[model samples]
Target: MSESRDRRAQFGWAFYDWANSAFATTVVAGFFPIFFKSFWSSGHPAETSTLQLGVGSALASLVVLVLAPLLGAVADRSRRKKPWLALATGLSVAATAGLFFVGEGQWLFALTLFVIASAAFFLAMVFYDSLIVDVATPADYDRVSALGYGLGYLGGGLLLAVNVAMTLWPEMFGLADRAAAVRWSFLSVAVWWALFALPVFLWVKEERDADTPSAGQAMREGVSELRRTARRIFDEKPVLTFLIAYWLYIDGVHTIIRMAVDFGLNLGFGETSLITALLLVQFIGFPAAVTFGWLASRWDTKKAIYLGLAVYAAVTAWGYFLAYEWQFYVMAMVIGLVQGGVQSLSRSYFARLIPEGRAGEYFGIYNMMGKFAAVIGPLLVGVTAAATGSARLSILSVLILFVAGGWLLTRVDARAAPSPE
Candidate 1:
């Protein structure tokens, strides 16, 4: 590919992040929980709603965990990463849109749609993350990965700002009320996701491997390949170690992102304040993600990741003692500084370690570990909250994940696998 085409493909791939992140910001991290509690689960106790949300999140992650590696393997063998991505995106968009029609006091219906959308959203990433190899050279992995994340934050943030405005001032948006605006926000995310996802389908071409198999053949081969890859990962010490660390730490990260709003509510913070704090993270995350990419180029990737993890540990610890809304905002600011940094670098670093032409399969496992961690993290919080009835104490359960994961990360040698230049 020419330099121009390469740049175009890179941007096209990154724009998918821009597209889908609207779901991440507008639904997953922003309005969904609030709506779930106040609208869907209207008469339920706060603790009961929190448990339901956690279980719903864990269920979504669990579905993706089971399917990610298999889908990845099949896509790899069939050479249909883009098609798979498209299918998942379409499903997610449909599911998200369906949320708008769910009636009040219908938490089960809302949760069901959320699970479907969330699962599809995560499954789409298995293909999307793998496509990074098609868009940029190995040497540019960190930069390209960071670019995707930066765009995601910016794009997600922009749409969320508009959605937040609609909720705050429903009359201006021609909506009936805040609830109507929130429903419209869900519909808006679906449109935004479908619209922006088009560039990737058009421009980011997947490289075809020789001897691609038929769909039926690929499914049979994919199952066998998944078994082999499982063995290979275990035998590869650095890969295994990094995955373990990633599983632990990223669990805390995912949990925090999913649960922060609920936590704020539990602590008596206003919904407006919590949403604003989330918006703060999105804006700050844009420049901060790019900066982390630059920092990784200057420093060791592992060290940069360690820095992010350290900050996360501190944030989780501080969350336990959080007393005021301002403190929550401060924590959000600090999290924004490192959230994208850690996630982007982990993707790039793992991209370097995996063999070529097998990105889909490897990143499948990568995402699987992530999803598995997510399962544990949310359940921990839910179980803890139900057991102790103290949201602060439940928040503290995440602290251990960061600390353990960071320590395990120390065992992985950065030089163990280097991408070919």
Candidate 2:
């Protein structure tokens, strides 16, 4: 494919978000947690189910956290994120499809998904994220990333809505029962993910600035690049500081993202109410994410991030006090309003400090740190919950991370928002 200079060409790139997020929606957030509880009961009670689900998720995350960088750097040097993207998305889709076959007492089915599905999902994100730098210039990256995040929310939400329709009215979808309807919801994600994911491989050109390297060459350089980027990140105080803050704060953000459904379900919300409220978040989050991007272009990016964090704190505290499922819906709306904006701005901010040629390698490290923190947050949440016998107390641990992260973020200067030359 011929290279095009127009930024709008990047629009097709953002559609990748619109493509794959259905998995995150129906399979990960909206349906699977509840489905797992009901399906894996083995006649055990709900709390036991939560404990098992938490452990499965943490194990899956641990795999991705360890391998994302090596896989990312190899893909970058090979100059084709599309192939890796295809492979990862394919694994996720296959796992989603397989979910249809899982049923009561199918604990191994859930375990299979936790391993293959989670690994593919997060590892695939490393390449997709490296594309942000490839697809957009600095001037446009804020909105481009925001657009991707927004569309992701929109796409994921749309699929979840369909899943909800199918689950709540399974007779209309030709399903046997509500549980079967829930199983079919996983099938919906598989189809949606495969169908929409074609544009990137079709339209987005992968340019490595030289001949594509072989696996041996990529691995040789991949290791070297990792070491060099690690040094650069640590030696540069501003980058180091921002990363520290980002590491800490993003822990809270991702913790909430991974655990929101389980949290709601634990609070005794009905399955329908939980999925419905989560769906509402996916839709509401779309426009809100875009709006935050626009606002960030005008305000200081860090300040914009701070605003998002502030809103998060309020929502968490409000959640701690909630008595009804109504509070979950309201808090979901509030989270949707700020979640994408904060995440998009943070990605863009990190992009600004990273050098051009090393985008993939650095983004790999970024992903490493990102997922490493991701690993810890859930582990902490799980261990704390198990020890205290209280999810409410576990929620407070996130507050400490947020405040410490914000304080670190305040010290990092956003002085290097330059486009790669």
Candidate 3:
């Protein structure tokens, strides 16, 4: 573990998050929502457009819930996580680049691209995250996890800034159409992702292959293994407590991402501001995440997470009061501070609790809980928005889950967590 820390291979491994986040920022959070509404909208009224996004998110979450665990298990067993990482990265990059061809009135095409891109991104993360347990010692887990998230925020923030500049100033990129600038933004993410991602494959050596089993055989066994691990861990009080807590909070977090754009759009922020603000969170997240990461090591990591949730709850409350664009900036900053920190540390903490040998199988079911909870967040927001006809009020709905999750997180016994071998 000491040898792995600060080694180029381990650093390279973390950089994969940096590499892939360009797509996550520019495509997922930034301009793609505009592309969906402007190009994809078939004049099917507000509810339908919202539903389409909801359904796509739900589908992506469903796929991720199933695929991430299997991939994690297979990678751990096979000792060959990189190939899967590379494949997922390639698929994501390709899908982001392909967004250029999806023009106005192409909502279906845009949704398809989103489905592919999101699935690839989330799938890649499972294997990437599992690598952390393998790479970092338990003590250094906090720092390693922090660095990965910090780099991701920096990378994602940088690319989104460039895309924002391009969108706001199309002539500089030699494109006359502003929409063309948007298209170019997608291309940039692809290039940035593909180029930056190469370092890991070059530097980070992969684990020994689990075994050479036929793909079909692995799938059958993986599913069986998943169920066994789920049951095994369910009986453990600490594991069950943490899983339930994680499920509840992560649902609110995922909902915020899926709904932010739509919510902003409904609030009448232009595509440029909403996307740029999204980029702001990425940059804001960079330093804040690092600070929170450092602080986690000194204080209780779960307490730090609880603090983040409190901030999120406050942000949700503030969102209801925001009537102008200026408040959005303030709230985006609030979001920046806790978002990455909460998520990164939550993952790092969870990794501490898993047995080393079955990390793959366990994390798979973990992904399922994360993904399954995702369905409720957006669905609730959509239902509430439609029922109340108030996007501002809709933001408040997320507060309940975060507060509840925070309370439950207190139930997790951190001392009992497994230490690195």
Number of the top candidate by TM-score?
1
RMSD to true structure for each model, in Å: 3.0, 3.3, 3.1
Better of 1 and 2 by lDDT: 1
Q: Model 3 misses residue 13 by how many Å?
A: 1.8
In candidate 1, how many clashes are counted? 0
Can you write out model 3's per-residue Cα lDDT over 1-421, one digit (the tens) per residue? 3464447776887788899888777887777766677666767777888889989988988789778877777766556677888898899889888888887777888898889999988888877777786677778777778888999999998988888888778998899877888888888889999998987888776556546666677667677776666677766677788988899898888777656656676779986677667777888898888888898899978888988888888877777787778877777777888999998898888888887666666666677787677566777777788999977777788887898888888888867764434
List runs of model 3 lying over 4 Å from the truth. 1-6, 40-51, 103-107, 209-220, 256-267, 373-397, 418-421
Model 2, span 211-316: residue lDDT tens? 7788799888777766665666676777788878889889888877656666776778877777777778889989998998898888877888999999877766
Q: Pick the candidate with the highest lDDT.
A: 1
lDDT of 1 by residue, 1-421 (tens): 8999999999999999999999999998788988999999999999999999989988998899899999999888889999999999999999999999999999999999999999999999999999998898867888889989999999999999999999889999898999999999999999999999999999998888678789999899889988998987787888889999899999899888767766787779887787789889999999999899899888878899999998988888788888788888998999999999999999999988887777888899999888776667888888898999987799888888888999998898857863422
What are the TM-scores, per candidate, against the unseen true structure? 0.91, 0.88, 0.88
| lDDT of candidate model 1 versus the reference | 0.90
Model 2 / residue 35 / CA error / Å:
2.0
